[model samples]
Target: MDVLEAIVLVNDMVVDSSSRRNDAWPELDDLSAISSSFYRDTDIAEGYGDSALEMELYRLSIEKTRNLVSSGDLQRQLGFLPSMREIEVLPVIYRDRADFVEKILDSIRSSPKNAGISTELHRQLNGFTQSLNVLPDALQNFALFAFRGFYYQELAHLTSASYMPHSWRSGIIRSQLNRSVSRFADVAIGAGEKVRSKLQAAINDEFGAQVISANFPLIASFVIGQASRRSDLLRTAVEIRDSAKATAFRAWVYEMERRIRNEQDLDKVKQAQDELTTLVRELEVDLGLQRKPTQEMTLTLALPLPLTPSIERTLHVSSPAWVRRVLRRRTHLVFLRELAQESISLPPFVRSYQMLKL
Candidate 1:
């Protein structure tokens, strides 16, 4: 089979991306599959005869082709997002005009010019490098932006406490966008439709890159492989898990257990019960409950916060430093996430929240 055939089937397991079709990249289902008399036999031979890099491309090609077999309507639905995230971090956008042209050609051939993004295709793609400006911000949310919007946020968090230019994002953005773009291309082509030119350019810039395709899965696997390393990343995951409120919950549980263990004096029993009641009241205070009783009406005061950390909650944390960091950033990401959910969709991970608009 052509190169696309090899990898398309690999995703029969990874149900995240094209999870719509068992995680395979739809590009594989297109003309490149072995079913196509054109490149099928030659591709398998090239597997042996080609350079190791070419062979890998041949292999990825199989995934690309296999992916094409799924329903083509994906593009019409997800036309706005770009295919790659690196396109954003790139100091210079564009310089990859031919690739975008290839994308629009594929899109138009598959679907109507009016159905997807519906703007004039020719007007959007008029600039090559100039089009690169579209890589940053909310615009990056589209399939054209690929996963750049998400990855951009992640790397910004990873690179520095504050977002800044860095070399590392190249690797991060590459992997994310590859998955995003391939999926977008799959559905886009399947639907036989066209979106805006900026989006099409993004698809090409991301998919066209040779460097990104090579490092993505390897790095992603490595990053994902070490449970410990990931545990250390962003320094906020653990903190979020063991948030102060969560710690309080555990403390309350321990006090509850301690009371259960001791069944002696009725006064002691009553005190324990009162303490537990006070703790719950304190929680309401910490959460900023606003229904203030102006008068001393039975004193429904909030309980005080515990001075000591919750031992059980602390133990659950794999890494406290990362957890703490995440906790620090969480408020910001939460607001951003709210905006994303309300205004736009935020990607699945904290990494997707790295860069911010306001």
Candidate 2:
């Protein structure tokens, strides 16, 4: 078959496998009940055990291939539109690999006791184990694409609400962006730890203490490096998302300024002013300029009594702390007001340059 035909065949296989897996769940549940019963026969128990193992291997295959098919990067590479269920499943898949490998190994080790299980089934299980033995290499390839997929997913989520007011959308997207970065870092580090622990354990089992001692540090350093690479990818993703947000905000600010300059309606001008005020407050917060509590100030005024010879009186006045905050905000309000009233005209180039500086 040609490449296109092969792609179609693989897609068909994935769909069929996924459907079969879904259909098998109820039967698996029934098997679980049967295996747990007091009257269960030996043959039935053995059959149930083998079925569960086969199901697990089958499920993993389906999930891995489905993840590959659903990957955003793969879709982009192949110039295909993403499916409705296009979601990043690699983190989950990778996270479960350690336990899955352990289970497979345990079954292999105990195979001699299960004399009733067919030779064909044993061969299939061994084949599955051999396939999984190459997982460290597979993970390296899959992880790069998976990280990109996650970044694109988050970027799309953050920028999707174009209908919302720019000020509100900006604040929400920034908050979400921060949270997403934190969450992605945690997941990447956690997955790395799991894989590292599993691989280290497998090496220890195979080679014993002397070999492990010699190679332990090297293995640890490699895992840590992988985790750090994931963090770096996350950083790049954040920068791209942040730059996109800044560009959108600049466009919005320009539009609002244009409206303020040319719109005849007082209400529209006022609306623009209000939106700009919100945007300015958000910017101040983002820039670390609006966090401290306001401070009160005391002023002394000296007055001379009208008829007395050089008689002087002093009056002390104090302003409320909140007044300072209002004054600070008033600076932006005045600029917005000037824009609304057409008292100041900013050239487009200068306006864009100022925004870029922001």
Candidate 3:
């Protein structure tokens, strides 16, 4: 398909999946309602356990995919129209790795001394994220399931990491690393646990059923229940990893929290932070993982649109290919591309000088 057609199809699929009522309650209990392909692929109808089990697994996969694509509640805010608002929502785009570091420093500088500045900063960040909530359903889903939970999750983590005192840098990095490990473990151990929980909640919400419905159809439910049992095995593995992490976190936090609570001397606090850092690195090795976080800094944009109810979008573009979506103004895109080409052709120092001028 052409690019536009492909894009349209994707958006249609997302909208349909998201808008469908009672989709969470698929009529899968009746085998006759399902397509022949399901039976053809499965051996369950043939009286073999293998095909039925495969069908159940496939259903779980399809269900999980639907949930992830429809999961985000990210919506755009009203009152963003440039004509109505005095100040237009300027782009707060992070372009490179350096930009991420700069944001970290900016967040550190904005940290409150007496809770006042911190409170204001928190409010502003909240407003910013609220504006982002109104992004397209598909975009929001991609951001959450594909991106770092729609940027807010990463933003919150970054804010916390930077808000600490400079002496606590090591401790902050360690905590960040721990979170990364937890995320990796979450995916590795329980592939769709998070999305599944969201889907299950949606199902329960629709049916007004308890968190789990005990009244599943006998044979069909048993087949589906087997998938849950398999997921339980993975959950057990995740729990083991989480347990080890919690033990290490507890040990480190004991001394760290004690120092903070007692208002201990800077040197002592630094010592505790150092110990935490070392412990985190050792734990990473023990867990057969990287000492440093593997996440890359993303290129993000906050662009405003002039509509009756103005909206702000959070765009996460990994490369120039995705930049087209962010550049609503074709003129801006043309200017940017020209500038990029020129910069690439220039020497490093000349390019830097031109960038500073821009």
Q: Which candidate is the best by TM-score?
A: 2
What's model 3's TM-score?
0.18
Clashes of 2: 0
Q: How far in Å is the alpha carbon of 11 misplaced in model 3?
A: 42
RMSD of 1: 22.7
**Model 2 misses residue 173 by how many Å?**
23
Model 1: per-residue Cα lDDT over 241-286, one tens digit each? 2344333433443344445446445575465444333333332333
Estimate the lDDT of model 1: 0.30
Displacement of residue 156 (Cα, Å) in model 1 is 28
Kindly list the per-residue Cα lDDT of model 3 for residues 14-93, writing each as its tens digit: 11111112332232212213322111111111232233232333233233323433443111111211122211221122
The lDDT for every candidate, in the order shown, is 0.30, 0.33, 0.29
Error of 1 at 260 (Å): 44
Ranking by TM-score: 2, 1, 3
TM-scores of all predicted structures: 0.19, 0.20, 0.18
How much does candidate 2 score in TM-score? 0.20
Per-prediction backbone clash count: 53, 0, 7
